[model samples]
Target: MHFIEMQATARAVRAKYAQVESERYGRPWTAEEIMLGFLGDVGDLAKLVQGKAGVRPRDDLDNALAHELADCLWAVLTLADTYGVDLEAAFADTMHALTQHLDDVRRSP
Candidate 1:
């Protein structure tokens, strides 16, 4: 799926779960709570990816990583959407530059 669609789907799932959690717990999350929740997920991803990290099987990390990464991406997309950024074009440009860097490295002695 395209990045924009993926981001929207992530937001929908987050909203649905937030509603269920709030109803179960008898309160909606405050902005601070939501930001902290996202921060915790960011830490989860960092734990998996940090240098010298104990590596697990890729399959084992997939589900948690997907959710945490989606949480981070959701925040970024929300910002981009608010500012009218063309995320698709930005991503393509960034990736093209990254590929060029890698190609340059491969060509080095």
Candidate 2:
């Protein structure tokens, strides 16, 4: 999917995360709490990758990677919301720069 669509999907998943957290924790989280929880989840993913590699599907790193990535999106999107960033533009610019960098690397000796 494209970057904007992926951003929306990430936002939707974050909303679901809030619902689950409310159910489990007995209240909706503050921004700080959400950020800290996301960090903890990231650490959990690292531990899972290191310790339970066999438990993941196809041994696909995506299982661990996706969780950590989603957490990152949650933090970034939350920051975007707070600061009123144009995430689509930011994403497009970053991707373009990364593609150029990769092309440069590939074309070099």
Candidate 3:
């Protein structure tokens, strides 16, 4: 699916979580809480990365890695939506800048 579609799907999942969370806790999670959860997901991703490199032992690392990556992406999409950032444009611009720097480096020597 396209990036926009991925973002929409992420948002829907986030909304669902917020609905259930509000019912459970009397309030939905704040952006700070979401970021904290994202951090936890990142830690999990790091361990999965180590598993992939043979530094950690795990039989299900491949599947877990994919799920962790998706979790990270979902967090990013939700945060970007919360903050009113256009991630697609930001991502494209960043890639363009990096490519330009690569070109300049190639021309230096």
Candidate 4:
């Protein structure tokens, strides 16, 4: 699926998780809490990356890496939604700037 479709699915999952959190914690998670959770996921993703590089031991590295990547993407999509940021536009703009910088550097002495 495309980025918009993926973002929609991520938002849906975030809403479901909010419901679960509400029932369990008396309220949905704040953005700070969500960010903390994202940070934890990032830590896990780091370990998985190390495993993929043979710096750490892990079974099913391929599946674990894919899962962690998806998890990270979901968190990113969710955070962008939470913050009301236009991630797609921002990503495109960032890529354009980076590419322009690279082209300029290549033209230098």
**Candidate 3: misplaced stretches above 4 Å?**
none
Best candidate according to lDDT: 3
On lDDT, the stronger of 2 and 3 is 3
**Model 2 score (lDDT):** 0.74
The Cα local distance difference test for each model comes to 0.72, 0.74, 0.96, 0.93
**lDDT, residue 4, model 3:** 88
The clash number for model 2 is 0
lDDT of 2 by residue, 1-109 (tens): 8776866776687688779888999876787876787688777776666645565444556666776766677677765764678887887899999999999999999
Model 2: residues with Cα > 4 Å off, grouped in runs: 41-62, 91-109
Quick one: ranking by TM-score, best first? 4, 3, 1, 2
Please report the candidate that would top TM-score against the real structure.
Answer: 4
TM-score-better candidate, 1 vs 2: 1
Q: Which clashing pairs does model 3 show?
A: none
Tell me the lDDT of model 1 at 37.
Answer: 71
- TM-scores, each model vs. reference: 0.53, 0.51, 0.95, 0.96
| lDDT tens digits by residue: candidate 3, 16-102 | 999999999989999999999999999999999999889997988889999999999999999999999999999999999999999
Give candidate 1's error at residue 104 in angstroms.
1.7
For candidate 4, lDDT tens digit of each residue in 9-72? 9999999999999999999999999899899989999999899788987778889889988998
- Which scores higher on lDDT, 1 or 3? 3
Residue 46, model 1, lDDT: 88
Q: Residue 96 deviation, candidate 3, in Å? A: 0.2
